[model samples]
Target: MTAETQLPQATGSCCSPGGACHDGADATTGGVTAVYRVTGMTCGHCEGAVAEELSGIEGVSSVKAVASTGQVTVVSEAPLPEEAVRAAVDEAGYAFAGRA
Candidate 1:
């Protein structure tokens, strides 16, 4: 018998690493979606780091970071304060370029 190679299945969510996923709707609580520009992200690792830091904020439902475009899409229960977002991005060792 010949051996066959198998690969992991895709979840089909836009949350994949280093890619842009705009679900258009919040994943939880029907929250609002906000997009912000960021700097210094050059790879999936950068995206993950930014996402992680932003995800830690209160009221955040979901986050998607795209390194190529230097933009992050965030879903939250309401509009988040600019300073809060900036601080989170800074915590991840990147610069927040404001809303996109």
Candidate 2:
């Protein structure tokens, strides 16, 4: 791998051509959203599991988990602390590969 190799910045979409994923955050509240690269989410149950765990965290307003894309968008009042997100993903029986 070259040192110049750079990962795409995390957005609502997972690196689409036009950068559109439609991961909606409540604009009225100006909620903060973070896209995480979650592993081992291959089914709806897996998505639900991850969402369920993440939703328990304080200040988390919503969670949209897409299994096929391996992207989990978490919407909260503010950018969530990494430790909180990491623990939630771990508790859900998945690997937390950090933000996208």
Candidate 3:
């Protein structure tokens, strides 16, 4: 994975976590995928919010957040800086447990 420094603030909408319906017009627009363990996500709405924030990051191509599994997968052109992920999770009102 390559490196990505600063990330942009997230914008949101009512959307699913699947790479369909949102900033996910192209699943492979970016070439790298990362997974993180996010605590406090326990339902679809939680997943949606997390997905929104991650998908809004500049290099991100798609985002999949599974609240039941506490996993957030982010696809991007490069490996995102940990701080960026941390911020997105925070923006989504969750705790960043670390990479998965």
Which order, best to worst by lDDT? 1, 2, 3
The segments of candidate 1 whose C-alpha lies over 4 angstroms from its true place after superposition are: 1-29
Give the per-residue lDDT of model 1 (tens digit) for 1-99. Answer: 111111222333345343333554443335666889999999888888898899888988678788888889887777799999999999999999999
Per-residue accuracy of model 3 over 32-99 as CA lDDT, tens digit each: 55779999987777888888887788877667787777887776877789999999889989999998
lDDT of 3 at 68: 76
Q: Where is the poorest 10-residue window by lDDT in model 3? A: 1-10
- Candidate 3: stretches off by over 4 Å: 1-30
| Overall lDDT per candidate, in order of appearance | 0.75, 0.73, 0.71
Ten-residue segment with the worst summed lDDT in candidate 2?
1-10
Question: What RMSD, rounded to one decimal, does every model reach?
Answer: 9.7, 10.4, 10.2
Clashing pairs in 3: none
Q: Residue 63 error for model 2, in Å?
A: 0.3
Better of 2 and 3 by lDDT: 2
For candidate 3, the TM-score is 0.70
Question: Candidate 1 or 3, higher TM-score?
Answer: 1
Candidate 2 — which residues are off by over 4 angstroms?
Answer: 1-26
